[model samples]
Target chain A: MLSTKEIKQSIRSISSIKQITRAMEMVAASRLKKVESRVLASRAYTERMQQVLSHLASSIPSERSHPLFTQKESVPVIKIVLITADKGLCGAYNNNIIQTTAKFIKENTGNTIKLIHIGKKGNLYFSKGGYTIEKYYPENVEKFGYNQVKTLASQLIDGYEAGEFGQLHIFFTKFKTTMQYSPTSIRLLPIEKDAIKTKVIAKGEYIFEPSAEQIIEHLFPKYIETQIYQCILESLTSEYAARRVAMIAATENAGEMIDELTRSYNKARQETITKELLEVISGAEALIKG
Target chain B: MAKTFKIEVITPEKVVYDDTVQSITAEGTEGSFGVLADHASMIAELQTGILTISDVNNKTVRFALDGGFVEILANNVIVLTDTCTKEGEVDVEKAMAEKASAEKALLKVGSGVEKEKAKAALKRANTLLKLANK
Candidate 1:
């Protein structure tokens, strides 16, 4: 049973917290809206890119001929690119993504795993716990430009081609909406060719300006870089959505706490006043009897 | 009767322009080339430059297409590349800035191939700015 003063103090502190959370929630929501618009605008480009890639893959006879798809003669250690948000308070968004990564690492067992963190949160957690990060690209979160992502993609693909990494997997949180997010990990190495994919055929066949093999070596790297850039965009958008939902919930919880404390304060005040009134009545009655 | 074929500027991102055009002047690897309707089935590697698509009215709409493959099949031009901008949508200031950077890169390059790429970037940026301002 807290005294009225204590209850009132608790209410004041809770109200202050409520204000901060409410402001955070609004900011997150606005950012989420902007990100969603960007995603929508880019979605059109993404579809077209896929078509172009499909056309290129089908036109070229040998995908393995490209170094991006070709594996080294000897199998070596594997690496993974793990992307997580820098800030917390977004419900279980960060936790879920990290857990998925943990499960994957556990299941693989024999593979040598390394992290390439895109966000501060992922870098902090993975490094603080003694995980070796092969590389981290936090610039993707602050200002996402295609060039930066393309550079990273080239480094990884070229490294893979040079036998630095045997296999690669990238992980991030996929944004569905303000209340929904899913962690996604996908394998992007070794572009395999299905007969249907290969046989789709180019409508008009022309001689390659240089050679068919040369065009592919250049195009394949660009494709991978664009794919990774898209992943970063999706992850950042999801982070904002998660933050907005988490802050909104926090604000509501604060409101509930304020209400509960007000009730407790009122009850305590009433009890104190009743005791004082009873004492006054007894004193008057004692005086009347004398 | 003159034959006009459809010039569909389909990018990996979206179909930017799809219409019946008179001809398309594109930068090809061997040199510059023009595409008219009913051209034989062929593939051409495009350099960064201004791709002009002329409508039936003979009005030319220019687009700055980055590096990509151009597929001409049955009168359609499918362009797959990293960046694209229509003349009306281009930011002249940004294009000028990009052009300046590319020019700077070319001045400091070590190889002929690197110089060519930088020159192509500058040319593309300049093309966009010119068309947008015009």
Candidate 2:
């Protein structure tokens, strides 16, 4: 049996761990609130942009094809954009993305797939793998800014225009609710007609400012950029939520562990005291008999 | 006495302006255009310039927008811009400094992509300076 002193040391260590987990839980909760609100606020702007894009897509006939809208005939190389969190302790947030990318690569063996990592976790995970990593964005999920988004978008646009890749897809975890998140894969290029279906077609009388062709060439890239930025924001929010939930569970588990350890420690101490009392009584009895 | 349309200007960060305005004068790529209520449903690509909105009460609000798209649909105006700042938000000293730097860059760059980028920066800086001074 372990001594009372040893048990006391173990309990003390567990208590400190519990304290750390509790603090982390609180931090994640507060950060999640701020990130969630930011994601919610940007919803309106994204919706409006999608609406305009859908309208434009419906108005323009399919025969007149823009570079962003036209799909190549041959089997084309695919670029997969992986978004993950910078830090760990988020309970499978990064693992899900990495594993998903791995599974996607496994299934699409025939096609040439290049990985574009957004967060540190993804870059770290994919860098060792045999798959070709095209680019890794250095910005952390929490520090994502408009300029970064613009730069990423422009690079992708230029690459697609230069025929670097035939298709592009972004993989991220969609924040569905506080407790649930799902890995979602969205196609970013080629702007398929069905992908942008208009809700209420603009009466066929909508005018384009500098003509339809120029607007399509100009506007579609911006739409894609906005979509990508929204995905990043959503992914960040989900990461915080996942971390908060995971930390809460961890803290509670630690509390339970501490309780169990304290009970055992108290029992060990009581047993030691009882043994000493018995020994002292025997010694007193022996002296009286002599 | 004047018809009003709902106008909302949004950036990636937040919604900068949302209100009922009598008319909006924005600088499009082609040229300057004034949009009133019940204007035909259309989309105009905006340039780096002042976006003037006249409220129903005849009060004018000017915002410096650094390139975006404007969509007019059923009397609702939604402006999606990269950078947006009102007259009250702009810092004159900072804008002047930016304008000077952008002008210098424009002069230093030779012909081609860098020059085009520098020119665009200069235009955006000029727009900010105009709004700050106003």
- Per model, kept true contacts as a fraction are 0.40, 0.61
lDDT values, one for every candidate? 0.75, 0.84
> What digit string (tens of lDDT, one per residue) describes model 2 on residues B1-134?
87889999998778989999899999999998999988888888988999999999999999999888998877888998878989888877887787788789887887798888878878887888888777
Off by over 4 Å in 2: A26-37, A98-110, A123-151, A162-164, A176-180, A192-199, A287-290, B1-3, B104-118, B132-134
Error of 2 at A110 (Å): 5.6
Cα distance off (Å), candidate 2, residue B116 = 3.9
* DockQ for candidate 2, C-alpha atoms: 0.52
TM-score for predicted model 2 compared with the true structure: 0.86
Kindly list the per-residue Cα lDDT of model 1 for residues A1-290, writing each as its tens digit: 89888889999999999999999999988888887777655655554554555555556555345565555535546677877887888888888888998898888767677788888777877877667788877664848577777787888877787777677888988777667779998665655344333332444454565566666666667667766776777788888998888898899999999998898899999999999999999999999999
Error of 2 at B102 (Å): 3.6
Model 1 DockQ class: acceptable
| Per-residue alpha-carbon lDDT of candidate 1 for residues B48-116, written as tens digits (9 for 90 to 100) | 777877778888888787767776656656666557788789888888899999989987996999898
